[model samples]
Target chain A: SQTIHQWPATLVQPVGSPLSLECTVEGTSNPNLYWYRQAAGRGLQLLFYSVGIGQISSEVPQNLSASRPQDRQFILSSKKLLLSDSGFYLCAWSPRAGATNEKLFFGSGTQLSVL
Target chain B: GESVGLHLPTLSVQEGDNSIINCAYSNSASDYFIWYKQESGKGPQFIIDIRSNMDKRQGQRVTVLLNKTVKHLSLQIAATQPGDSAVYFCAENIAQRGSNYKLTFGKGTLLTVNP
Candidate 1:
């Protein structure tokens, strides 16, 4: 079975501090990776998605950025965090089998509180 | 802008009863839809999905109905349990020209099951 691991399940960062959240998938190769953020009322908002290594497509423009440094490993980073960046961040992966109906598998998620 | 929205923000149901959550979408071009459940401080988990070709799909005690005519989708949970308390979200897949499709989510509806 495939499993995703996200580190620092909860974090408290001060404003303007650097942020780094990591997500890695095991038991799957060349999977489509994605990063999403969810606020109190807002739904799961797609922030970035990667098709392959070094290829990322951003859906929303904000203080965060995502990178796929290696296959099965995705990282969401920010040089300086903002108060608005606080939210529940999720990492997901889907099979890239040239099919249109791919289901996403999500990790436990990271809850960031920027103070 | 195209978006997916839920009819209700919250719902309360008694244990052992059936529960129905409704969603409405604006984009008629969306060909795929999904339902996700998220607990507090956790990432959304995939519950069930339906394509444009299918009207309904069932999994375990959960059923998803898609009505393309009204652009509405619904999720029904049979014999609802207390563990089923969570926020349910509906998502629509928007295909990008010459690129992988993106999944856009609705605001979500909170389901509370009372014992």
Candidate 2:
């Protein structure tokens, strides 16, 4: 079985601080990786996705950025965090083959609180 | 712009009752749809999915129905339980350039099951 691990499970960052969240998948290789954020009582927003190492597509312009440093390792980073950057961040992956109809499997998620 | 939206923001149901969550999308070219469930502070879990070629798909106790004619999708839970309390989101897969695709999510509907 495949599993995704994300950390820290919860984070508290001051405004204008740097941010880095790591996510990695086990038991799968060359999977499609994605980063999504959800505001409290709101929906999930796609931030970035990657098809392979060093390849990332940004879904929206924001204060955050994502990078795929390895085949199964993805990182979300921010040089300077904003108050609005606080939210629950999630990492997900889907099979690369027959990707059109594939469902995404998500990690436990990381909750970031900016103060 | 094209997006997915939900009909209700919240719903409350008694335990053992059936629950239905509705979603509508504006993009006619979307060919794939998915349902996800998210508990508080956790990543959204894949519940079920349906493609444009199929109108309905069933999982353990969940069912997803897609109506391409009206661009509406629904998720039905049989004998809803307290453990089923969570936010439900509907997502549509929009094809981008070439074989790439993006999953667009709707504002989730919070479902509360009372014991």
Candidate 3:
């Protein structure tokens, strides 16, 4: 079974501060990973998705960036946080081309509060 | 003009009643569709998926119907329960092998099951 872990589970940061959220997938290598944000009582907004290490495609251009340092590790970062960035952050992984391909399995998620 | 959309912003159904959430897509090139459920403060979870070749697919307690001609999709849940309360989103993917596999999601419909 594959599992994804995202942390810190919750974070409180002042506006304009740097932000870094980490997501790692266990039991799967070279899996496609994605970053999504969900505002309170809202749907998921795609931030970025990575097909391989150092390769990323952003869906919505915002005050955020993503990187894949290792096959199973993905990171979401920002030089400065904005109040609008406050939301629930999710990390999801899906099997690459040879595997299942379409079903995305998500992590528990991280609650970000940019006060 | 290629897009997926929901009919309602929210739907409240009584427990044990049938629930039908509707979605419309405009892209004829899209051959795969999916339904996801996002609970409060959590990530979107995969519910069901249907391909263009099939009009309907059934899973545990849930069924997904697809209409290629009109480019519409719907999810039917039998015996709605409180646990089913969540925001549901419908997404579509283009049909092709080695396709980066990006899913365009609808705004979403909130489902509130009253017990």
Would you list the clashing residue pairs of candidate 3? none
- lDDT score of residue B52 within candidate 1: 92
TM-score of each model, paired residue for residue: 0.96, 0.95, 0.93
What is each predicted model's overall lDDT from 0 to 1? 0.91, 0.91, 0.88
Worst 10 residues of 1 chain B by lDDT: B94-103
lDDT over C-alpha atoms for residue A37 of model 1: 90
Per-residue lDDT of B3-104 in model 2, one digit per residue for the tens?
999999999999999999999999898999999999888888889989999999999999999998999999999999999999999999976664556788
Fnat of candidates, each listed: 0.64, 0.67, 0.44
Q: Mark the regions of model 3 whose C-alpha exceeds 4 Å error after superposition.
A: A99-101, B95-99
lDDT of 3 by residue, A68-88 (tens): 999999999999999999999
For TM-score, candidate 1 versus 3, the one ahead is 1
Q: Give the higher-DockQ candidate: 2 or 3.
A: 2
RMSD in angstroms between candidate 2 and the native structure over all alpha carbons: 1.4
Candidate 2: how many backbone clashes? 0
Docking class of 3: medium
Worst 10 residues of 3 chain B by lDDT: B95-104
